[model samples]
Target: MHMKAIQFDSPFNIKIKEYKTPTIGKYSLLVKVAYCGICGTDIHIYEGKVPFVTYPIIPGHEFSGTIKAVGSKVTRFSIGEKVAINPNFSCKDYGYDHHEYCYYCKKNRPHFCINWEAIGVTMNGGFSEFIVCPNTSAFKVPKEVSLKEAALMEPIACCLHGLQQIRIRPENTVLVIGAGPIGLMMVSLIEAFYKSKIIVSEPHPSRRNLAIQFGADIAIDPNNEVLKDVIKKETNNYGVDVSIEAVGGTTTAIEAIDCLNRGGKALLFGVSMPEDTINLNLFELYSKELSLFGSFTNPHENDQALEILKNKLINVSELVSHIFPIWKLEEGLKLMKNKAKDVKKILIQIEDNPKEYSEV
Candidate 1:
């Protein structure tokens, strides 16, 4: 059997090609992909900006699908079950290719494993008709969650991990820098779980309004209004208790640190370039006793992400502004690259006739 897939032959070169369908190992599952989200990492790989990515790779980590076949040893999941995949893989989990566990993996931090590999980033991903992944990497979707929404589980998990890093309090005042899809997801999660007084900084007018709609108490246009000034005014000069930087820029990262109160915590959830650097004031750090955190991939938060989606705690549907077929993925990527105000989360529909699943 053959399956169609989109492959990135090299930087700035992508094509749709047919290849023999992949089979599963004893601990694997063959999944018929439903929807795959195009993420920032995908863009980096496409432009040859990600140093770890190799050529001729299929790029898509945020996806959900139905299982068509399960390996004999995969008793946890059955055929026809809907599942979302966690792309991060430890050396051992990648087919046990390496017996020696990395330090981070042994410490229960596979996201930081020295030999870490991801399904889409370091291997073939879901920009195809079908995928074969370890059963351990797949999580079953709840009855209340649609495959479309389930496709967003990966990002949701990432956002959840970011929030966990900050340890947000319900009464804390929080500022989210950027109103991109990831930023908005942070906003929604903070509102739903922490009930924090949420403030958003976004230059785009539409996204600013969207932030407000997503429970932001104040949405400031960073291009016009000063973020620190606005934050000062909002918090009566105390600054926010927590600040999340989701824009993946040095300016926004500095803003996240600068707009914090004494003993404030900041989570740098953005994916910056390898060469990006920031200038920090050591005096401010010493005086305020501030804490800064860098969040990587989702380690073990996929189940919580699924629960959040199943309960409709976060509005994933509103975040999805456009859906493109697999063949039109490049067009979607171009739109995202142009920073279209109307484009939020873009999903690549893999199945020609996707089943009409009920939404939560």
Candidate 2:
């Protein structure tokens, strides 16, 4: 059977085409993709900025869908069940093609695998009517969870991992730089889980308002306001306990490091370019006893993301500001690239059925 798919043919080029649907193999599930979220990496790929991305790729890693068919060996999932994709692909299976685990994988850090092949980055991904992924990458979506919201599980898991990088407590004053979708997710998750005093710094007014609505205790316009003053006043000059850089820029990263307590932890959660560079003060970093770390893709946290979504502990639905059909994916990409003030998360809807058992 033929199905519609969006492909990034080359840099500055994208087109929708009818492609042959993939058949499921043993231990694989044929998923009819319901929704896929347009992420910053997708924008980077479209602009030919993602260093690892190749041309002629179906780029969508954050997605959810229903099982259309299951291979004979796929016993964990059944047909018509909802599932979310875990795009992190481990390329270091010991017995596969005589493969040996890389240093990172050997250290149990597959997120930093030397030969990582993420679904959207290296392999054909979910910007299509159907996809075939191994059962290990599929996490069952609860009946009460909408597939549209379930599509965001990947990002939620990533943010969850980021949160784990820092030791957040109720007394900690947390600051998140940038109020984009990921930053907003950080705010919501921190609010729900840590109950920390949250502050968000965003230049855009709409995003600042959104941060407040999503449980930010304070939202400051970084471009127009003195962010350090706000942080000092909020924390009684102790600075924040933790700072997260989500804007993926050197300035925000510097700001994140600057606005921290003496022994605070900093989580750099943004996706920066290969050429980007940031200058740091090694003396202060040492004198203040600061800890800084980088967070990569989600690692074995999809089930927790599903639990968070299913329990409705965080308001992820509010993060989705726009939804476009699969045919208009190009327009959606443009909206994401332009960073429209109101556009928090842009979703490309392939199939809209939310019921547990239903035909599209």
Candidate 3:
């Protein structure tokens, strides 16, 4: 059987070609893809900015689908089950001939695996009609969760992982830099669970308003209003307890660090350029005892993300502003790359009849 897929042959060169449907191994599952969310990392891959990506690869890491076939050894999941994929893979999953696990993987941190490989980043991904992934990498979707919502599980898991690193308390005041989809997810998570005062810094007017709607107590336009000044005013000059940098830029990262109180914790969850650098004040670090953390990818938080979606704790539906067919993926990519005002979460619909699994 043949399937249509979008392949990135090189930077700025994407093609929609018909390829043979992939067969699964004993530990894998063949899934008919439903929806795939375009991420900022996808843009990096498209622009050839990601150093680890190879040419002629299908680029989609956030996706959900229904299983069409399960390998004989895949007893945990059955055929026809709805599932969301965790794209991160360890050396063993990549068929590496290593007797001992990598240091990071051995410590249960596969996101930093020395020989890490991701489904869409390092291998073929869900920008196609079908995808074959290991059963261990797939998590079943709940009855109430739509495949569209499930497609965002990977990113939501990433946000959850970032939050877990900082351990925000209910009494803490939180500031999230950037009102992008990932930033909004962080706001939603903080709002739903922490009950902390949430502030968002975004330059775009529309995104700032959207952040307010997503439970941000104060949405400041960083282009006009000073973030540190607003942080001081909001916290009565104590600064925020937690700051999350979701916009992958050095400027925003510095803002995240500068707007924190003494003993404050900052989570740098953004994906910055490889060569990006920041100038930090060692005196401030020593005086305030600030803690800065870098979050790579979702380690093992997919299930928690799914549960949040299942209970409708976060407004995932509102985050989806546009949907494009697989053929129009490049168009969607361009819109997202340009930071179009209307773009929030751009979903690429792979199946012609995704509604068929609406009840799944």
Model 2 agreement with the true structure over 1-360: per-residue lDDT tens digits: 999888999977889889999988877889999999999899888899988888889999999999999989778899999999998877432223324777777777878877778888888898999999888789999888999889999999999888887879998999999998899999999999988899999998988999999999999998887888889988889899899999899989989999998999999889999999988899989999999989889976789999999999998778888777777778778877777868888888888623332212
| Clashes within 3 Å, all models in order | 0, 0, 0
Q: List the residue pairs that clash in candidate 3.
A: none
Every model's TM-score: 0.95, 0.94, 0.95
**How do the residues 1-360 of candidate 1 rate in per-residue lDDT, one tens digit apiece?**
999999999998999999899988999999999999999888889899998899989999999999999998878999899999998887556655434777777777888888778988889999999999988789999999999999999999999998888899999999999888898888999889988899999988988889998899999989898889999999999999999999899999999999999999999988999999999999999999999999988998999999999999988899898888888888878877777877788898897743442221
lDDT ranking of the models: 3, 1, 2
**Model 1, poorest ten-residue lDDT window?**
351-360
Q: Write the per-residue lDDT of candidate 3 for residues 1-360, one digit (tens) a residue.
A: 999999999999999999999999998999999999999999999999998899989999999999999998878999889999999988656554556878887787888898778988999998999999988789999999999999999999999998999999999999999998899889989999998999999888888888999899999988898889989988899999999999999999999999999999999998999999999999999999999999988988999999999999989998888878887889889988887885688899897834321211
lDDT of each: 0.90, 0.87, 0.91
Estimate the lDDT of model 1: 0.90
Better of 1 and 2 by TM-score: 1
- Scored by lDDT, the top model is 3
Candidate 2 lDDT at 24 equals 81
Clashing pairs in 2: none
Off by over 4 Å in 2: 91-103, 352-360
